[model samples]
Target: MRAVRDFASGIVHEVNNILGVIIGNAHLAKKSSANAEALEKYMGEVRDAAEEGRELMRHVAVLAGEQSSRARPLSLNDLVINVTSELDPPPELDLSSEEATVQLDVWMAREALAGVVQFMAETKAVTSLRVATRVVGSAAALTIEDDGASPTDDELRALFAPFTKLDGRPKVGLQLTSLADLASRSRGYVTAGPREPHGLRIVLTLPVSDGTPSGDRPGVPLSKKGV
Candidate 1:
């Protein structure tokens, strides 16, 4: 199928990027052997890249239903906070006050969200990003908005289509397609539309476990980091 091929192409692209990191860092490590600090830094980068490649393979396995039994109930709010905090330039968070625990594989969900955020942050046209969450009916919605050049409806559709490449923005198509695939596996859905005036809005909704408010509402702490 075309979808499968697009997914494969995207995976190859991502794997190439990871391998570039590993190879570049390895060479740096070799060259910096005399400088203990530089050598350690390069080695660390190489190790991190290798671990990322390993995780990517695991993600592929999970997507193929080989490791589909690893999901658990987790607080969506907490996961969002934890993952976003680790981003190089963390996005602004306007998270939900209520805790919405959902059944999900942490790695899959984390990678989906992080990949999107990172893509947006790296985009030359995007200026700002805001992430928010809300419990809508039986599902929890994680929405990410960006102040960037708004895509037309046709463009938006292409972004969510698996393997649908975009001009100079193939990564967007790849990331969102992977996200759509993962959401489908969990009985969730992804929606995207042009934001008012300008920019784009994307929402990922997943069913919450029991739909009960388990814990006290957390305080809203704004992260004022530049994107």
Candidate 2:
């Protein structure tokens, strides 16, 4: 077990280093070129692929016992807001929401959310997506929905499996799997399936800690807040 863990860590570190170089060069290329439209598009694809590689490494690292032990009070609302802001999805990507609150480890939630965001951003099939959060009873729910193509049965099954990428090599990576694992470790679970007429929806359910605030906790302010 120890050897396996060490090997996984090594792999993750090596991949991260490679990805860093790719992203750096891509940025430099984008900045130096006069007619950068084509170059930027190509570099965007490359950067996305490298990000997938890094995400896979992170997932393996988690399985290799690279998670922290400390648990701090986390605000899910804040985490979601931050991720959406950083991604800066187009205005069409509706970010509707309801009041949701929870207390969890800030680092864990951030990492898990980051993984999810990265997965969506890297997936080519997914064109427009929206993320919403709600608080019900003693739990918090986060729903990420996309109007992209629906996943086949095989793709759905492989969604949560480690290193399982989708067709066209666009969906292959460790982001979703890692995020699922992170949720599980935090006493939460994630589910993904077809939504409405077309597209897919992923819901993450997490238990709310006792004594946590009911209204907007500290940190970032989301789009909508409710009790």
Candidate 3:
């Protein structure tokens, strides 16, 4: 298992490096284009394709169990707020607030946020995504509900199966699984289920570090961390 994980991790790293070069060259090409007509369109596609590939590689790494787990103090409230704002959900979604604070790793928070965002974007059924975060004694919780088409039981079961794309394409389901793994590593867990009436709800619960301050430290970068 460890050998397989290491091999997968190496592949992901190499793929990411290649993607970085592709994106860089594409950006340079875009800038150099004086006409900005035909070349611009092609460059845009290249950029999108490269980004998608990178995301796929990330998911693969998680599925292969190639990533190490790290835990630190984090601000649950702030993380959810930032993620929701970035998603820019439609007005139809209602988001609640919980006046609590807790600690977790920043990387895990970002992965959870990205997973929700990618799921929504791919399904296209979600009109809105809302998040509510709360902190209790020695633990933190985040509840993300999306007003989207509900997945069947089989689909939900397949969610964490590596290389299983919900959209019937080659997609890596690493985001959710990686988040779950990270939570478990931190003495926590994650759950996903149907929301009231309709839609999907994902809840993340993790051990909270006591009175930890959020700051810019030399921890793992979100992109390089894992899928």
Give all TM-scores, in the order shown: 0.68, 0.64, 0.63
Two-way TM-score contest, 1 vs 2, winner: 1
Model 3, runs deviating above 4 Å: 1-47, 58-70, 90-103, 167-172, 215-227
| Cα-based lDDT for every prediction | 0.73, 0.65, 0.61
Clashing pairs in 3: 58-227, 74-103, 74-104
Question: CA shift at 121, candidate 2, in angstroms?
Answer: 2.9
Residue pairs clashing in model 1 are: none
lDDT per residue as tens, model 2, 1-227: 75456446656665776677787767767775776676777577677768757655555666556444755555566567666666755313333264455655555566667677666666666667777777777778888887666777898876776555465435444567667877777788999887777677788998876645433343454333111
Which candidate leads the pack in lDDT? 1
Better of 1 and 3 by lDDT: 1
lDDT per residue as tens, model 3, 1-227: 85457446655665776677677767777777886676677577677768767766665555556344455565665555455444444322233354344455566567756675566555656666666666666666777776676667886776554334454322444566666666666677878887877777778887666665465322323323544
Candidate 2: C-alpha RMSD after superposition: 7.9
Consecutive 10-residue window with the lowest summed lDDT within model 1: 218-227
TM-score of 3: 0.63
lDDT of 2 at 104: 54
What TM-score would you give candidate 1 relative to the actual structure? Answer: 0.68
After superposition, the stretches of candidate 2 with alpha carbons farther than 4 Å from their true spots are: 1-59, 66-68, 90-99, 213-227
